[model samples]
Target chain A: MANTTESNLPGDDVLEEPVPAMQQLLDNPFLLLFIGIAVPTVLYTIWGVMEIVNLPIAK
Target chain B: MAVNRNFRTCPTTGLVFHEPAEKLMRWNAVVAVVALLVGGVLAIGVLLTRWQAVHLLQADLFYQFLTAHGLNMLVFWIIFFEMAILYFASSTLLRCRLATPALAWAGFWLMVVGALLNNYAVLRGDSSVMFTSYAPMGAHPTFYAGLILFAVGALIACFVFFGTLVVAKAERTYHGSVPLVTFGAITAAIIAVFTIATGAIILIPTLLWSLGLIEHIDSLMYRTIWWGFGHSSQQINVAAHVSVWYAGAAVVFGAKPMSEKVSRTAFLLYIFFLQLASAHHLLADPGLTSNWKIFNTSYAMYLAVLASMVHGLTVPGSIEVAQRLKGYNNGLFEWLRRAPWGNAPFVAVFISIVGFGFLGGISGVMMGTEQLNLIIHNTLYVPGHFHATVVIGTTLAFMGLTYFLIPVLFRRKVAFGNMATWQAYIFGISMSGFSVFMMGAGTLGAPRRHWDISFAGNPFGYEFPATAWLMIALMGIFGVGALVGGAMYLAITVYSVFLGEKIQTPDFATVSAKRGMAPAPQPVAVGATGHGAGVGAWGMVAPGTFVLALVFLTSFVLYYFVNWKYLSTVWPLK
Candidate 1:
């Protein structure tokens, strides 16, 4: 049943082709998730300090 | 042929994850968590400062943090996450590639850069006008620019979602009707498009005015049109989160709506009527006529509330029917009692339904009343009411969905198992208390957005009875607990995604992939004439949920009348 469904997919021939191992690693869900989380955390921490310096006294 | 190559089948769930779409979802979800972290830290500062005794930050810094907190949590965190959900529903559920993966990446980066720019403007200390940013009290031009970029990005994302739906239909991804979850996502995307358009219409001019391109922006015009963006943005959250509720029920319990036609009609009702609730904000303004306010707040808005009530009943009713079929059929709540309490997703859904209906729903109707609006217009009660809706209702449901995504999408075992189990309860209960205490203090005449509730050193100071101070203190304590809970969620998710044990399949002890993203199973026919199953009948299937609904209605009625009675005392008959 699963194989039949796969064969019936709209572009089965293109989907079945294998990809380079490096692209596969770069596309790993965990790796992407990590970059997503880490970049913001680090940037925001620096931004927080920048905010404090820019606005030393509130109007 | 290209379509087949770009998508991979999840072995456990059998859902197709298009490579580019999957990457986009991961990035959006990650950015959302980071936004939540920034907002959470600021939340603790604001909460402490509001508690008269602690009064943590100075007046200027308090307002700055308050402005940052509102935008980051309400706009940045939720919209980014909803964008991720949009991609998941369209591409993954329909088993098709995203319509424009490159455009989707552009949207993501625009939103990130825009959010950071907005934060930078607020942090500079000049834009302490709070989230409303009403006219004549102008901020730097960059604030408006950041918001415009964010709105445009969100608008593009919504179009991408709509395009994906078209692709699904063109390719015949499903046989007949799209799944209920996908339909719900469509409702969210439609509302988001309207919301972003309104935002752009008002904000673009506001940006020009700030840069001295225009003179004399009217405060009333700004308030009236801005709510069309501000409050309606929340309506988008309501649609998206309630969809999450239905999706969570389907995923966790294998549940289907008790009446699919009724549920779909309710979502349609949302499209027409939900935005009208924005009038509640303008009710107190002298510029709007009483007749217009009355029509908007009462007739049109009640229909929107009715849609919510319909959802409130059917979501749980569906869960009850599913449990009954599984033979948890002892009494009024055995089905509920025997539910998967240990599971984070189910816990979030159940708590969200209860909190949104009881706290958010009731208070909303009360505040929307013309006379009642005067009582709590800019009081702490307003924020209290929305915390119930946005935080408990939408944010918690999103958090629950994250637990499922961690293992399924990221392919890692959940870290800090005990903390993950307690995260929802700690956050939900403390937030529930926070809402109650904030409202209580507002009832005692505490002003919202005042740096010092005590009004220290003022020539004309009015003391708000000692109890208001106590309630504010309690709000601070509960807020701290909620912050801890939010931190736990962030910690657990971050550690798990980065460092936890890797898994090849979705069927780990922490995450179940039994049904996955497949369409919900059809409910069993209960009263078939040929079989002995006819003995049980339709009435027996969801009795527990019916009883719960009755209890909810009774509480709502009592609360409504109590507010009226309180109003009568405030202005006795002449």
Candidate 2:
């Protein structure tokens, strides 16, 4: 998909040149994926453990 | 090889807008600036008191400061800004003149007078009962008087909006649909009616209490009703924030959501379901029954959360579509590449959304939960979460919008363009850093209002969390960022008004163009254009979004209906 505007990219009409660093990061979606899942998992896991600790054992 | 010009730009202004509508928007920005300054001062004072580790005044005075700060910043500043922005966006997009300019000015004065009286009461030591004026914490007679006056002023503003709607309707300017931004605002205004009404309900009695006519008001009752006002007022903020996002995306980058209809529906959901969402605030507070809390806080919040989730997905979904269309298609990275990252409004909106979604959403959900809220309720975490979302998210977007809005509104040359970019970065980074630190301190169990952490007789002689202190001190750096950024913005605005280059703007172009006429474009973007493009697109679904806003509306209605069917015989309301 192209930008809705008819005007060309001003001055520098550089098309589809991949920036190395961004490309590298994009290649590994797992990094963001890991952080996303790991973070909430840790937090919620802590919450679950706390709940378990606070639970009363039936006699 | 070439596309038929889907959009046109005027050679004179280098953009598109109607003249009168632009003028009205400019006036709105001017008033907003005044409101922001007043609110900012109160906020700065509060922040200083928190940061300096010294009580500037006694506890009572401090309470007054806190009260004044909340009223000034939260109610006066944000609402006034929203009103101005809302009017500009709605009227411009609809292509109509303000139904009554006199009514708008009247609304502005009413709010100004109300704010002035409220502040004056606080200064006089007449009404420092804090913003909520929770019954027995009774304010001075003057304080209640000011509140009533302010509420009245806001009501008048609402009426002025109706006037705009009437004008738009009668003139056939809107072409059978309200713009998305205006539609969201209508919902916001609808919620505001509830918010202000609840505010009036609480303030009138509190005012009576201050007058000595009423012996005493119950704190519990006052708080319950007060939250009705307090909670919903924030919904107005939430709606405004969403509206700003839409506007900012469109203006800054020429981005439009894939489906205006879906986005508009999300906003309407807020109107129907926002009042019930307030229960989340009281989840941890005592006095409310567990059952009441569950229904109002937990169950009620489910719909609100769903609403947020829908938006959480949909807004970005729209952006993703926009980016895709822009030909960023290097897979996922292609979208990122194609986004208008260079635009200040674009960057600010993105950063705010990301930060609010993560930090604000995290703490908000945790605090609203029945079980998790117990640990962090009333802690510094509460403030941290709110500031992250409301301040960084909403306030930053407003600032970003203003960059374009001020130039167009006032028809003045922006004093320092490059400096504005740096200012945005500094402001965004610092606020985010500060919020994270504050939230961390909260988790460590640091109390919010203790001037010092010193402990005289505790069994554990350690005064407070050392890490908390360090984090808070670190937050001062961000405070500097906020101050400097604010100063830069102020300087540009002032310079533009007095000394910047002047340009000839067309007469009545804003309203006339909105009415779909081939009108002369003015120097700057009007309310519903440029920074508010997404909002304009969203306007098409104004009437319907309220009916089907998915964010909180669905869960809210479902919760209400379900509970009504099952427990109506036993519940308190019945």
* lDDT values, one for every candidate: 0.79, 0.62
Residue B384's C-alpha lDDT in candidate 2? 87
lDDT (C-alpha) at residue B72 in model 1: 94
| CAPRI quality band, candidate 1 | incorrect
| Tens-digit per-residue lDDT, B1-574, candidate 1 | 2333255566555567767888889999999999999998999889889987889999999999999999999999999999999999988888766887778888988999899999999989999888999888899888999999999889889888877877766655654456777767877776677677768877999999998898877676677668777987898889888989998887777777877778877876676677777778977886566665776678778888999999999899888777766777677888789999988888988889999999999899989889988878888999999999999999999999998888778878888876776998999898999998998888778999789988889999998899888888899888888898899899999999999888765432222112222222234343112211212234556777778889999999998898888887777665
Worst 10 residues of 2 chain B by lDDT: B1-10
Best by TM-score: 1
Calculate DockQ per candidate and list them.
0.02, 0.02
Off by over 4 Å in 2: A1-59, B1-24, B52-61, B453-462, B504-574
**lDDT per residue as tens, model 2, B1-574:** 2211122233433543334445545665666677667666665666666664542555566666778777776777788777776676556565445555566667767777777887888888767666556667666677777767777877777666666677666555544346667766776666676677778877787777777888877665666667777877877787788788877766654556546656755654454455665666667655565665666556656556556656655566556545544444344444555666666667778777766666676566666766666566677777788878787878887878776665566556666667667667777777888788777777666666554334335677665667877766666556656766666666766676768786565532322232332233345643222222332123432212232234434554454354334333333543
How well does model 2 score by local distance difference test? 0.62
